[model samples]
Target: MELLPRRPDRLFPVLLRWMAIGMLSLLAHRLVFLFMYVFQAVRLEPELQDGAVASVLKALFVGLRFDLATLTIWIGPFALLLSLTAALYALPAARLRYRLLNSLFFHAQWIWLLWLHLVSVASTYNFSVNGKHLGWEFAAYFRDLPVLLAGSFVKDPVPTTMLALFIPVWVGAGFFVDRRLSVHAGAADGHPNPGRKALLTALLSPLVVLIAAVVLFRGGLQQNPLRPGDAMSESSPFLNNLKITGTYLIVHDLSDRGDFKTFYPPEENTAFVQRMLNDGRPFVDPQYPLLRRMEARRRMPGRFATIAGPGLPGRPDRQPNFVVLLMESWSAKFLESHGYSAEVAPNFNRLAHQGVLFENFYASGGRSANGLFSILTGIPDRAGRTILRSSRIFNRFGSLPLLLKKKGYQTLFVHGGDLHFDNLDTGLPHLGFDHLAGMKEMEDSGLYSRRWTMGFHDEDMYDMLLRKTDELYAGAPERPFFAMAFTSNNHHPFGLPDPSFAIFPESDPEAAFKNSYHYSDYALGKLIDIIRTKPYFQNTIILIVADHSHHANLDYLQDREIPLLVYAPSFFQPERRTDIAGQLDLLPTLLSLSGGDSPYAAMGRDLTVPAERPFAFFAGGSNTDIIGMMRDGFIYYHYLRSSQSILLKGTHPVDMRDMQAEQPQLAVELDAMTKHYYQFARSLEKENRIWPESISE
Candidate 1:
């Protein structure tokens, strides 16, 4: 270096070669997905007929467009890097360092390609289970990959273990291909001449390539890019799916369809939807179609005449304050009211006896997001989709907070954990909450828990809630208040501040869960005690419900069973209702209890009234598409993918897989119920009328 450093070689030529090779490797990666889909199709089919052959050919053609778009987006950043490398390598100096950089980028491309193929392969299985492409809406909830992987292994260990073994072979093959193609990437070359002709060509070449990449990224000058539905020309949904690659589908979903709304044709299904909306109910006008029926209900003709009146007929004129407590992981599994271990939740038992408890209540899905969305939106959770914290589509929904705000109520959402954990922070405000507070707010108030992840203990949260409620109501005594509080101390890595609160020893997970459950119950008792001492105690109503069951067996009633306790001693009767109910029923019930006369669109009927359909619909286990209908004393399950159904008698510790064979006739009932729920959801999305305030053009 003391002497003049040796001039490096020309850079543009090497960069060009690298870009071409990367494009080829990306094409190869796409073929990997194609082959996997074909492999699954062939295995599922005994022989490939002419129809299948035609389907495959068309799929390949349609798939290319999607693949091209994916490649374009994937290589945009890489292209920029290559352009910089090209200019630097063209310089007489720094050529060696640039060559090394090129090689590293080459290796990085192969690693990324390997990851893409792996995800593509795994998605085939996911599709098989749910009969839907795995999209970004579903992927957004993959926050805890380790836990998800472990749960998958526990569900079916053999398949996961085999996939793990094959991953190395796939990655190694990609590495080998990268090595073969990039052999000349680091080779030294003559320095580029500084002539105007050479400089112009170098600049123009990358510019042209970049322009082409941009066009491809926007998907070939079309008004809109290719979507998942674009590949649905085939008669068979399964064959139609073969035209879509998993990676392309996920990318397309992320780009468009923010809420993951279904594409089912609502106009054609108007009559079907009309039947579902009424179901021979006395309150509904059977002559009207879906939207017309909703309009009719909004009128609430002649004194809100119905079989069941709004909650507490004696106090209908008084608008009571509402507080909904979404207890974490508080499945009926741990509730003594549901005949669990008697020592588990003494306070809940006492509370349930003093109020109305739904004996057949169930959560609509396994996740907390499902319960939260259904409870607040009054809509059934869509199968195989997550809406909470999904920034693209949260504000689209009609929320309870928005409805209550119209009625002069102060709306608040409180959680002991980080509100931003699942995108709740953005979503809650959009839902019409005036105040959204979480762990940060709790800590600021000097209420912090050392044993908890987000600091504030369940006891502290409840205590703070009492104070906050006082302040909110005090601000405007004329305005009623509605608040939702979520507790997290009973969740995984469950713990309690006071060891003496545990009735059972923390020797195992179930024991530890019970201990934490008891402690939460103790905190709830404290909150209730404070409420009882308040001046507005008689005019206040508290609703206790679980987000979802955690440790319950996936059989009939046990899996979806959750407690729904309505505590309003001055108004509602202290009797237990045995009709089937779900999280979706809470909103309409709350509105009725509030004695609000305004009409609203709700998928669930008012639970304060008698249940029109004595069946609760819920999705459980690993597959969300497996819809379950719990009615009478049996649970019927319908697998939407294969149109398979199984009936399991209501009992504890029964295996769902080992249940009785398909009931073809009863399967129709389950199908109708599932379709009805989705039809309503799709109709709302199509009309863009989830809330009464939403204007539909």
Candidate 2:
């Protein structure tokens, strides 16, 4: 066939390309879908949803495989646009005919799209699921997006469907477009060029084949990390399926949570305690059980030196209205602006000047829940698992809200996301919250006009919180106020809510986190403005601290740590103290600052006014592998798996002796106290107690 791009032959190639693309797309979607579904079914027993097996089957089949309904929905608009635009490309005046052009264009489009999906799926699945970034070594697994989808298969299936759709359109569109476009009449005068050049353009066909192969591989790897209620383990049925089918060849260690231990005293197998304080050797005779138990139960002096040595006399003047804004993903030492203002938060700098900003406050855990537990409860997380999540298993925590409620304070717990998503409803109110307001509760309220997420905008939430503050102060003159506010926009997939007031710039981040930071600042500003206008500003002591500081799965905020901003009236001069602290110290700090003896002795010291052992602990659970940190700056990050440690100059490692010493000390004074807290909380949870005079813990 001596062709110069004839129409009949061209159409066949276009159709072929589309078929291959579709097969490849749907195949990959099914692989990831089935993988996640199967993983959850075998590894976890999710209490959130009803039928695990059915949901898994639905996802494995309808959700992942041949989501024709969604495929059409996504492509329908693009198809319309392409068809309209093809009119121009198909016009006779155009030199390029649709016949030879469409296939190539579609192939090129698919390549770009596959890369985008790769990034998306990878970012989600491969993420560390830890607190945030660490230095630069974050969860850069090019595979997080797929992993986090384990249990939350039903949240947004569009991404999976889109991946399926993208593969085919990308593959087929180019070929089809080219073939159709080639029909334009390029007369024999100029277009009389021989057949091979235009027709043999399929020489580039092998490139497409390689791309198709990668797409197939990509699909097979995606799995959900949040396996509904169950944490996934190595023995997942999905992994077996992958092995049987020979679909996916590699399985990555998606999370550091696994290798780490969560229970008290770390894992028995690990040598962390032995290595840290024991000169990298076991304290016991290696195989002695009794000796190991003896070694493990010991305690060391937690506060080596002065956390905060007793010093200044009490401020004779009334305390200021403390507003502690714990910026998400923030660290006290990390913000470059603290060193050189050219690169970091200007608003923080301003706030630091306005109030006393403690420079060395560490987060209690690598998670928001961890920070909240520490700040509100003052008790560090048990050896593993967050106190809030582990409450059903262990003891429920006592919140600052509850502690303050006894002192005549009406408490409010507010956040921009769902209160019950992570059992905040079960936990928060148990801690004595008078009101729990989250995105679900923001319905029809002006506080949340925009809705990318179900939660109200931070600005809107702030507005609502301020109004509530006003109402409480105006009407309820008898009770003091305690409010815990959580900002959400700066969270992962950090897309901006409003660009006009963008505080942080985003040349580009997968998520525009800078914008979220800027927004957080604005929310704080709004809060401050409200405080200025109200009388509560003068009397209300607001404590601002981060829920936890992490950027997505990697917590880079370790340096700056969480900030402790206690804002009150000018009566309390902004006295900057070098008392190092953590979220655990918030309660005792507040209680001490209030000059009232606590109902129950606090694990956290009176950090607000400064006391001995100024630093608080960032007790890492299994997720981060880091263990206790002392206020005197002794941090112990037990790499639970390897047992290898890198002791920064400031912190010391917790050895067998330390554990031996600390455990008994914990047992002696704190154990009974801690147990009482749980007993009290259980009673409160059962009795429908709302800020009762005393819960008894």
Model number with the top lDDT: 1
> Following a full C-alpha superposition, what root-mean-square deviation does model 1 have from the true structure?
17.7
- Candidate number of the best TM-score: 1
Per-model RMSD to reference: 17.7, 16.4
Q: Could you give candidate 2's per-residue lDDT for residues 61-107 as a string of tens digits?
A: 43332233223222222332233333333334542544344435444
Question: After TM-score superposition, what is the CA distance of residue 231 in candidate 2 from its true location, in Å?
Answer: 18
454 Cα displacement, candidate 2 (Å) = 6.6
lDDT of 2: 0.46
Task: List lDDT for all candidates, in order.
Answer: 0.63, 0.46
68-169 per-residue lDDT for model 1 (tens digits): 666665555555555556556455575556546655765575566556545644554455554544566246535643454465456546655555445355
Off by over 4 Å in 2: 1-324, 333-337, 342-344, 382-384, 391-396, 502-511, 551-560, 608-613, 621-623, 630-634, 651-697
